[model samples]
Target: MNIYLVYWNSLNKFCFRGILDESIGEGTHFLIPWVQKPYIFDIKTRPHTFSSISGTKDLQMVNLTLRVLSRPDTAKLPVIVQNLGLEYDEKVLPSIGNEVLKSVVAQFNADQLLTERPQVSALVKETLVRRARDFNILLDDVAITHLSLCWKFVTGGNCQRCLEDAVTRIGSSCRKKEDGRALNSGCYLRHSPHKFYNNSSSNDVAAGNRGHRKMAIILAASSAVLALLLVTATMGFFIRKNVMRKRRERKQFGTLLDTVNKSKLNVPYEILEKATNYFNDDNKLGQGGSGSVYKGVMPDGNTVAVKRLSFNSTQWVDHFFNEVNLISGVHHKNDERRKNTYTSESLRQRFNRDSGMHS
Candidate 1:
């Protein structure tokens, strides 16, 4: 094996040769064994620097400093040796660095890079790594160490136009205000005041007119403030009313839920099942146009009616819960009387049917 010394200049061109006793040409060269040998490259780190001026979105010039680490990509050595000759650094590395830097920097403005240095650095590193992949090189990192603006053309006289523009704007605003006041007061410019302003009476009339206009402005402002206060009060009233309404609704719903939970109608599913004998036909009391009604007896010997709706009873399905809720809310004081009347009527009909059968 032979030891080689390698050095790549700023242009990315490589200069390398085997150990030889004397200096050789600029390109890569070979050497014989031990009889004549050259010293190998002993340096641990190398630096590559390039300078360029970039343009911002607002057409400002910025000077940039770009420094890159120099190293050989051993994975692509074979291809580099075949196509680019032994001086691969001269042909590949500089080109990659320059293109990646130009492309990435051109996408950002000067202010962005200056304010967001870390982000800009990361962007440069990513771009370089992607471009280096084709040559089998991995970029370790990239950094933007220095940035500055080139302000060689600024002068004091350049601000004269900006000052004149500001004065013109102020004059235009004052003229517009004066013209509006004249129009509001219905003043016809029959005579030019440029000459008549020398008279004392004319000056007094102008001063009085200005005082009247000032008083009108004060009155208008006071009216606007009063109207604003009234609107605010009305809005607050409506908001409070809506809040109170919602609170009442919630309170009522909570009370109704508590009453239902505590009522005797809070029958368990298992008890309902035992009372109805698993919904047997023998337990069914009557069949109506809507559905069959079953008679169920509770564990405490209390009788209750259970109405099971039929599948096709769409009208019953819609009104069943509403009817049950209405019936549940009837005054408990009259409930016993109503129940007695219903039972007596049912018994009378049954007795009449039996008598007719016997006859």
Candidate 2:
């Protein structure tokens, strides 16, 4: 029991232990064996978040998650114990929070709450802090953790801008890569084998309303005609420019391929399946909860351990690659050191005429 030292009388052999008289922050406190009675009160920060349904100024019913951080006032401990007691959170705080949230939300429209979250949160915190002091509680902060509107409105202008930026920027920058994705605040661009497209159907609908596809085709056709005329007018200059551009592109491709080859640690699934004879039971090396390991022989007579990871083992994929990268770095460093040592030893042997004569 958490008992503060209140009044102790040795002559009468009576002790009073209560939260009202003295302040005890936290920890175990031993009381007089029989005469003392103990009363405990928790003095820790309390956090609570609950969903509240409130009507906005625009008559829209919105659900918001109201979060409150508070603690009992150390100076007003006696008042807190005498009046509110332990059931304050259940009986008092929730109702006060609900009322304050409704009053604050009724002042703003749903759009204001959505667009100006910081201002709304600050107002709630200020109002709640003042009110909590009356109940002998110190309010730390208040926040609208989440706000959900009854309906969502998609802006056509934002989606159009996102699509234009992605198409013009990602297409030109990531043209050579087979697959990639670009993300923005409002929309995302996804690339597959076919082409880049908006991940959100809403964005596609919005952009389509502007006739972007038709405009693109029209521009392409017009550009092709213009290019044909220009080439006819300056054939030699255009040809020379195209040749130089092709040469530069070839050099870039070679550099990229070389870099990729250095870190090529992936094996095709189909090849692994074929090498293990379609994961025959006879070729299985071990089996466990996370799936089986198999022994496979490559065409070059090199044996490899192929793991058939379970579908549920997806969480380990990142860890597997991390360990692989670390091991690769260590091996690469060791290879470089060995190469340098061999080169140094060979040069020393070649230059040492005394050692050669002794040999």
- The TM-score values for the models, in the order shown, are 0.31, 0.37
Clashing pairs in 2: none
Instruction: State the lDDT at 319 in candidate 1.
Output: 47
Question: Residue-wise lDDT of candidate 2 within 1-359, one digit each (tens)?
Answer: 33444341111123553443555445445555667655545556789887789999888888989888887777666666568865666666787888788999999998899898999899888887888888988877787888887753347986798788888767887888888677655467877788455578888798797798789899999999999988887988888898997676446435533533454433444556677898888999997554577887766676666655443222333333443354346654323321100122332342232211000
Q: Per-residue lDDT for 1-359 in model 1, tens only?
A: 45444452111222353222222323454544544443332122345666666675556677777776655454344444446654555566678766776676777776676787788778877887677667655455566667887543424554454445545654555464533211111122222324543667987899999999999999999999999999999999999998997576446435534543554344444455677786679998987654566777768887766655443222322343454565466777534222101122332343334321000
Misplaced by over 4 Å in model 2 are: 1-19, 25-30, 152-359
Candidate 1: where are CA atoms >4 Å away?
A: 1-45, 152-359
lDDT for residue 104 in candidate 2, whole number 0-100: 92
lDDT of each: 0.54, 0.64
Please tell me which predicted candidate would have the highest lDDT against the true structure. Answer: 2
